[model samples]
Target chain A: DQQVKQNSPSLSVQEGRISILNCDYTNSMFDYFLWYKKYPAEGPTFLISISSIKDKNEDGRFTVFLNKSAKHLSLHIVPSQPGDSAVYFCAALGGSQGNLIFGKGTKLSVKP
Target chain B: DAGVTQSPTHLIKTRGQQVTLRCSPKSGHDTVSWYQQALGQGPQFIFQYYEEEERQRGNFPDRFSGHQFPNYSSELNVNALLLGDSALYLCASSYRTGNYGYTFGSGTRLTVV
Candidate 1:
């Protein structure tokens, strides 16, 4: 069973627009959420993360919002640039030691 | 500092063959985790090693085993490989404590035929 899900497989947006990626989870024990970006042939790079205690966290142009009641979370990039085009995977930490469970991932293409 | 480094960028193996993949963690990091990523899918955790012991393991089978050396480097070994085992193997390194985010290696792409 897929504990975390990212329904959108691909998304395209123009430069300077907002790029949003959504993820949902079925497990209630997940308390920490993280986003990772990956390029072709490279391992995923850590992006932003949010703890369950907070509803929102922002870093520069990237922001993450979590809605506990809905069992959903989203990553938003404002004024998205072409360089931001990559596959984004949403991950959650479950259990006490923070073992991570990842979603399928969404490929984002930001066109100039 | 050097980030996580994995060797044998690509490999090809026949069914039932055995293969070993290597990894060296980043500087000052002592924990290593292994993950397998199938095409167009997110990574699946295999197991994690800390202090040369298997600390946590996912739903993988016994055919997949690993060893962490005293130097904090690691090796992942797959025996009796099946075609379904073909995927990108990734190694991530993190510290034992603190909020240190994992640093991943480029990965070793294994193709089992």
Candidate 2:
């Protein structure tokens, strides 16, 4: 069973627009949520993260909002740039060692 | 400094063959975790190693095994490989006490025919 899910396979947006990616989870034990950006032929790079205790966290242009009651979270990139195009994977931190459980990932393309 | 480094960027093997993938964690990181990413899908956890011991494991079968050295480097071994085992193997590193994030390597792509 998939604990985390990202239903959207791809998204297209214009540069300088806001890009929003959504994720949902089935497990309530997940206390931390993270977003990672991956480029072609490369490993995922950490983006932003939010703890279950907090509803929102922001780092520069990247913001993550977590809704514990809904078991859902989202990553928003404001004024998205062309370089922001990549596959974004939503992951949850759980298990005894806090192993990451990742979603299928959403491919975002920003056009100038 | 260098981030996580994985060796053998790509490899191809026949069914039933065995392969070994290596990883070197980022400087100052003590914990290492392995993940497998198939095409068109996200990464799935395999196992984790710390202080030369396997600390956590995922749902992977017995064919997947790993080892960690005294220097904090790691190796992932897959025996009796099947075609379904073809995928990208990634290595991530972080502090044992911190679960905030991980530094990932470029990954090694293994294709089993």
lDDT of 1 by residue, A28-102 (tens): 888899999999989999999999999999999999999999999999999899999999999997654446789
Worst 10 contiguous positions by lDDT, candidate 2 chain B: B94-103
Off by over 4 Å in 2: none
* Model 2 quality (TM-score): 0.98
Candidate 1 TM-score versus the reference: 0.98
Candidate 1 structure quality by residue, lDDT tens digits, B1-113: 79999999999999999999999999999999899999988999898888899888899999999999999999999999999999999999988822348888999999999
Residues A1-112, model 2: lDDT tens digits: 9999999999999999999999999999999999999999999999988989999999999999999999999999998999999999999997888899999999999999
> What are the Cα lDDT values of the candidates?
0.93, 0.95
DockQ of predictions, in order shown: 0.64, 0.76
Model 1 DockQ reads 0.64
Q: Judged by DockQ, which candidate is best?
A: 2
Give the worst 10-residue stretch by lDDT in candidate 1 chain A. Answer: A93-102
For candidate 2, what is the DockQ-based docking class?
Answer: medium
Interface RMSD of each: 2.1, 1.3
lDDT score at residue B60, model 1, on the 0-100 scale: 99
Candidate 2 root-mean-square deviation in Å: 0.8
